[model samples]
Target: MLDLRLAPMAGVSNLPFRLVARECGAGLLTSEEVDARALVQGNAGTRAMLRHLPAERPLAMQLLGSEPEVLAEAARILEAEGADGVDLNMGCPVPKIVAKGHGAALMRDPLGAARALRAMRKAVGVPLTIKIRGGWDERTLNAVAIARLAEDEGVSAITVHPRTRSQQYTGRAPWEVIASVVDAVAIPVIGNGDVGSHADAAAMRTATGCAAVMIGRAALGRPWIFATDAPEREARAAIVRRHCDLIQGHLPERIALVQLKKHLAWYSTGLPGAALARPRLFQARNASEVKAVFWGLW
Candidate 1:
């Protein structure tokens, strides 16, 4: 089977969405990035990111941090709470994240990242993986170096988003970089970035020889992209309904409202009259209003 999975997306890949994506055929789903220090400190908000429904099992929890001891403790906590795997976030290009020496900032300091990965690996029995960018910037395109180092540190798998921090999400993702990581590592390499459909996933696998493909942005309004076949309009509507139901049933009221608005907007993408309907979607004061507006447009 062609292995396709959902990439951990901050504010998007919570348990409800993970369940929805998995039901749609995502092979393995990852949680949004949780702050290691906050989780270790027992921060309630961070703890909430760790919540998972039984159906979302075989899920990996992704952590964002730079401290070795803190990351180690966080990994232990996640493992104790039943995470199937722990992934280090090494590719996030957000200014705040990189400024803190977390995420893609680690790409600039291989030795430090190695220490953090080593600590986390020793702290948990579960598989340790990492998601990394091509490099800190164009001149520093060192994904292969990071992949080799991660493999040596006992990281079980690597997911490469082949765009430098400087490039961010702007241009084409260099598939050749993913191919380089695969050639450099004996472990499984998962390719991410710029994949919006099954055809793109197939092309990535063919071009890079990657063991799996992870969908990030492409799956935003279309988790059905994970399904082996394109769902008909009715089936697609059913999926949106189920996703909304899960969001309401599983999330806190305040969060549920925001998620309802965000996802409904995404679901409406490309539909007739959707552009005009978006303002009303966000203007909605309650879930009922939100759904009514969205379904009215639907």
Candidate 2:
């Protein structure tokens, strides 16, 4: 069994975010879902996403693509670039992505995904894994079948975010499907979605028999979620400051400060007039403005 993992948010899991998640008690972290084609063609933005700090050990670079050749090459590139592992994106169900037959579209084509997994297994020296949903839709639920295929192809692990593609982040993730996946694969299966507290994480393990838990939306502004006893306003200030410093250390001061605006909004929820604070934080263009949004408001 592994530790708590941080999922690769589409636009958020950069070096700074992963560093912040680590400080908040995440065991393993994945970079944002990267486009394999972008890496192969030398996209600077995609390359920049590969940056990491010495303290952040065992970080996996998550890749999103449907082509076996490109995905294999990208996995090779990640191994050469010092990544600890490579995880394929077979679960994303965004319309724009699915239209291209890239994301959860793979759920509809298990044979192709299996073939891609095999190719990537042969291409990379480091550990290879994949993240998948229940299936393209409720009608085609086949997570157990896909899990076996990835395992047969030598994937190190499989992550099951149990919402079907059609559900798309709506409703609760079906932990039962995770149990099915764990039963089907010898490798570790990390559970994902809707875990907001230690109890939720613990329940996920108890209910699904998964080895690890991947925190997504619940981890956004609540990184210290596992550490906080009560997770009230009393804990918000300290977490915000620590995250701000982490961001500052990893990125430009201004970017870090502004980025905290979104997180602050989430942390400040349930407080008196958090609505007022959100607009102010977005309107906050500097550090002093951020301080006011947090300190003055409280």
Candidate 3:
């Protein structure tokens, strides 16, 4: 009944990657959080990071900035470029963003983060959301406070990763805390933490009373996660073949070969010879060599 949202990992959630995840079972996929300042400068790499296949729809673009107005301007810039929706990344713990007083650093300044959310909501007519962590540390766990602010500002949704900033993606997320925030806010609450399986997806919804569950890390190389029926041998073969072909569809010959190798690991994970293939895949730098390894093994 609830949808599964894909967590945006930089260098990992590119357009080709999203397409693969979509085919697997992801209900909504977000692009890797883009740097607003870099995009404004017309950086080529930044531009490329924004690429999305036409099928990877209902895409949400996340912008990172600390200042309320600056973040608002960035949200407007993305909305005008035809983003289906926009998300503000208030939970990123990267020191670089924190150094600029952004990302999870916002947890230390809820008032400021709230004002930024208000400004961005005022600026955009599209669905606007906030992805937040519990707080800066155990001593400052204030996800409930942040959720309240998001609701007051009229945000379309709020996603809580449920770990303190100090926890930084380690340890289990505090699932019980999600109920407090859910009770406090009127918008959709996307619960994210250690959901790696469809069972986890169903459980997260029940555990937190969240409207949806979001997944990261677990999804790598495992599109079958969304459709887990212990795929048959023939189906497995077909999926691997199709995933490889999908990579080849969008990427150039050389790039596809190299990139598909990584995907091969994702597809092959937990399979009989998957561990043997990971190193071989990463070491592979071309398509023909990758095909040789895969086809030779297959």
Candidate 4:
């Protein structure tokens, strides 16, 4: 079977969403980005990102930060808490994140990224991985260079998004960048970006020789993308209900309400009048209200 994994999306790939994706056939789940400094400082919110049910096992937690020492300590905490692996985030293009010298900013300083990876690699016993962009920008397309550097530093695997930070999430993802990284690295390379269906996953592997495919934005509200075939409306409804149940059961009331509104809105994507109904979904004051608005549309 093709290895289809859920990309670690900030604020979206929470426990409930990951469970839904895994149930839909996603492999090797990853958690939302955890802040290395905040995690090491024992921030309650940062620690919450590490929470996982046993069923989500074999999961890796991705860390966001630029400091080697802070990241090393954070990786240690994740390993001690039972993470299957630790992933360094190097592809986030958010302006605030980049301004902090984290995320894709690290791509500009290969030596700094290597040092951080080296520190984290020695800090944890579990597999160490990284998700990187093609480069800092078009002028510096150095994914292959970074992949080779990661392999030399004992990184277990690499995921290439193949878009320069300058491109952010816009424009066509230059998959040839992925192919270049694959040809340049002996370690496994996972391809991400612009893959929305099983067909796209297969095409990525065929085009890039990637060992796996990570689905990001495309999986939003449509976890069934990981399933071998798209489920019927009745089945999709069941999945959506199950997802609602999971969110309610696993998260606090306040957070559950937000997630319920967010995901249920995504679930409403293709239904007639969905565009107009979206406002009501967000206006829902509680889970029951949210469900009422959504199922009314369903």
- What is the Cα-based lDDT of residue 105 in candidate 3? 94
Clashes of 2: 0
What tens-digit string does per-residue lDDT give for candidate 4 at 128-200?
9999999999899999999999999999999999999999989999999999999998889999999988899
Residue-wise C-alpha lDDT for candidate 3, range 203-288, written one tens digit per residue = 88888899988888887766666564656767767777777777788666776776687777666666677677767767876776
* Best-performing candidate as measured by lDDT: 1
Q: List the residue pairs that clash in candidate 4.
A: none
Candidate 1 stretches with Cα past 4 Å from truth are none
- The 10 consecutive residues of candidate 2 with the worst lDDT sum are 225-234
What local lDDT score does residue 6 receive in model 2, on the 0 to 100 scale? 84
TM-score of 1: 0.99
Q: Using Cα atoms with residue i matched to residue i, what is each candidate's TM-score against the true structure?
A: 0.99, 0.92, 0.90, 0.99
Maximum-TM-score candidate = 1
Error of 1 at 205 (Å): 0.4
Off-target runs (Cα >4 Å) in candidate 3 are 228-230, 251-258, 295-298
Candidate 2: list runs displaced more than 4 Å. Answer: 228-236, 252-258
For candidate 2, what is the TM-score?
Answer: 0.92
Per-candidate Cα RMSD to the true structure, in Å, reads 0.6, 2.2, 2.2, 0.7
* Residue pairs that clash (backbone atoms under 3 angstroms), model 3: 221-266
lDDT of 2 by residue, 269-290 (tens): 6668777667777888786677
